[model samples]
Target: MDKLRKALSGRDNSDEQEEERGNIMTQTEDTPLLRVMDNSTLSWNTRVKGFAICFGVGFLFSFLGSVFLFLPNGITIFAVFYTIGNILGLGSTCFLMGPVSQCKRMFATTRIIATIIMFAALAMTLVSAFVLHNKALALIMVVIQFLAMTWYSLSYIPYARDAAKKCFGSCLDL
Candidate 1:
């Protein structure tokens, strides 16, 4: 019984130690924003949990939005829910990569155009839904949003954009 108890306590201690190791932060250059991000960084487990919850909510919102498309005022409802889901999904990445790093990557030269288009599409989606109330325009903007987001995501993978361009060019030529 005593041996079993020691083993259980040892396991608990190792878990705590592992958590502490994950929580340790390394010093970086002393800039105000970096300092804030460094200070605000969460433990690995907490970060993963936050990311999962946020991403799940984002997916649910998008699914609900799609479901509402057949009802009255469905376009506006769909636009709003879909836009919110995209925002949440984008924001969820910040949990895995610090906000500063995420922003830097977002605005990087290769992806800047895609990022701008994505953001513009998101804004236009809302504007079309609320202000213009044009279902066709809203749908168009949603398509743009999805494409821009895809392009932006592809920018993160090396040569992905080039490969896509080549594939599309060949298809167009054919």
Candidate 2:
């Protein structure tokens, strides 16, 4: 946790370590860390980037999934969409970590919205699967995806708010 704090602040405790070694600490006001901490707008910019990336991924998933649906071989198309969707969704979350770590409120809000959308999407997919009465492979994939999304949202929501509070005092603050 201390390491995380240091990385997020872009600061090192070398000055303090030097002081303990009977060495005098030099003040470096022109350091990048100083500039970063002094500028509140950078944080806001990061949040904007984060939100855009998340929304873009969701859009891509929907578009690609729709396209795949029109292809031949129902089971194969569903499998492709299921695999790609999960991979892309997880990858996008990894990208969001930078902004999420910096802007807690924005992260929490976006994550919650994403969770809700994921739930709805899964529900709709299940209904479609049942109606289509296609191959068992597609149905099995949907069930797996449903379980994964359900577990992810359930576990994520329970701690997301607390993590946001610990990372930042208020939403949209630098």
Best by lDDT: 1
- Measured on C-alpha atoms, candidate 1 has an lDDT of 0.81
lDDT of 1 by residue, 72-141 (tens): 8799999999999999999887776667667877898998999999999999999999999999999999
Task: For residue 145, give model 1's deviation from the true position in Å.
Answer: 0.4
TM-score of each: 0.76, 0.39
Q: Write the per-residue lDDT of candidate 2 for residues 1-174, one digit (tens) a residue.
A: 657434544336773476466432135545655543342224534744755676577557646765776667555556456645655555444333442333443236545554555555555555555566555645565565655554454444657656755666765465
Clashing pairs in 1: none
Residue 75 lDDT, candidate 1, scale 0-100: 96
Candidate whose TM-score is highest: 1
